[model samples]
Target: MTRRRLFVGLMVVALIVCMSTTLFGAASVRRYAYSASNPGGVWYTMCGGIVKLLQEKLPSNIRVDMIASGGSVLNTRRLASGEADLTMAYSTHLWECWNGEGIMKGRPNDNPRIMFEIYKSDHYFVTLANSGIKSMKDLEGKRVVLGPPGSGSSDNSRFTLRTLGINAIESELAFGDAAQALAEGKVHAMGMSGSPAAGLVEVAATRDIYIIPFTDEELDKIVSAGPFFSKGVMPANTYQGQTKDVPVFMFTVYQVASKNVPADDVYEMMKVCFSPEGKEYLGAVHPYWKTMKNDPELVKALGIPYHPGAERFWREQEQKK
Candidate 1:
């Protein structure tokens, strides 16, 4: 009876202190700012999932906002300026931004925290069946529809093509606008990087277009060359005339944010994000959520320190293991 009373007294004291801290901390407002590449792309949709999850999990006073930007490079710039709390970034871009390569070009921003790996995006080198371009070598003289300037896919396509030794003239077309260019014969090939069933590929399917497969030698070279590279396949029957899976280069998509954000906020945000209740939310937000099921290994390869809040959430996940 004595011990029980002592335990109860300690619990009461702990609660009182917590309440006092809350009361004192009320003046310290927390505002979370997030950004994504396109206004209506997968990034915004997935961010909506995070927002809803965080809303239910965070303290009532915390504010969360999602903004739109041009692409990963722009998002990285915003993060560097401390303008965003969180954002979606390509793994390749993250590597480049960290190492000052590619579009980052000696302007690396190391002030970001890698929270988690979001998805694996596959590269698609698509063309009409009649275009007569059967391999990467065939694209040398072809007119290619690269993605919009400054978009993540555009950057990936450019670097990938250059690495593969293809030097086709690039047409600055967005994924949504590529079908018309292909149908008009203005371009012989279109380079895209996304999920196997991406909307752009669906559009191409309707027009009897399909992606070409990369050779095993090509896949091996990419994976051995960079931390960002991976192997992915577009399964058989995804696009018109595709009777077998198409091989392609792939890389992780990362959930990231500015390092200056408070650790506590980052923790709760990620807690809600990876919770069982958030699974359905993620699936509804993007089909790529299936890839997130392999998150443990993915997080291990995050290549940067997690935000304090995100680290706490990951620790809790580890406890469950």
Candidate 2:
């Protein structure tokens, strides 16, 4: 409880320290800030990969600076507030922000526009194997990191917990911090969502960590709660452990852009994404991209209007093929 309270109290301090972030751009160039997640997570790495690609491929007049942020919910706020030009956010987070619900409830942000769906984030409820936390029901009364404050992690955690009738002592710690705490046995489980997520492989390398799969009953409760939730799976061998697939709740992670961004810049960005070489280039950046292609269905799934620039690029791609 001390570590949980301490981490909670540090929110103020973390905010102050996290206020400053790395930005890479030229003074004379047309630059935009992209909000992403912490170092250990996939979003951070994916954003970093795109940052390098944009810097190298886009015309010198444009620059994209990256901000390692809390996670999806915060990224949505940044986009809606004109603080960022583009970001990748969970589909549920985007849906909630657009309709004035979820974490940003009552303050509807109608500005978020979908670019494309990237991959699905499966919720992984991780606890030390010896803890005997074999399922979501086992989490009751235990200390858990319910994901970072204003993140999709926390958003999912709260709803799932409410549905399951379980309330673990929760803290909103970022991926890296929570992983550290878990390693020290400060928390019983760390709830997170990501593809090729952090901590799984690392922690499993030394200690035995078990991933608690969401039961069908829990998945039905989640999906019945809203259209945003879907069933997902963690393939066999995704992490070193028992070899069978695990059932999990799933949602889309997508690239989002604002209606305010200059259309030409957005078009150029989209064009580069599906360019002949880019099609092959992206798969190498993150293994998740292996399944993503220039598919119109990916955009349609988000259920939001697209930025004109992004729409034009996709339309052009369709016309060509």
User: Which candidate achieves the best TM-score against the true structure?
Assistant: 2
True lDDT of residue 255, candidate 1: 83
Q: How do all models score by TM-score?
A: 0.80, 0.87
Q: What stretches of model 2 exceed 4 Å from their correct place? A: 1-28, 294-301
What is the model-wide C-alpha lDDT for candidate 1?
Answer: 0.72
Instruction: State how far residue 65 of model 2 sits from its true place (Å).
Output: 0.4
Q: Tens-digit lDDT track for model 2 on 1-321?
A: 999999988997787666543223334468889888776667777888777777778888888889878888889999988898889888888877787877678988878876766776787677888887888988999998988876777778787888888988988887778877887799999887875676556777778777788878888888889556788888878877747788888887888888887788888887777676775777788887655544466556656888888888878878988
Q: Work out candidate 1's RMSD over C-alphas.
A: 9.2
Model 2, position 320: C-alpha lDDT score: 80
Model 1, stretches more than 4 Å misplaced?
Answer: 1-29, 39-44, 48-59, 293-302
Candidate 2 lDDT score relative to the true structure: 0.79
Local error of candidate 2 at residue 39 (angstroms): 1.6
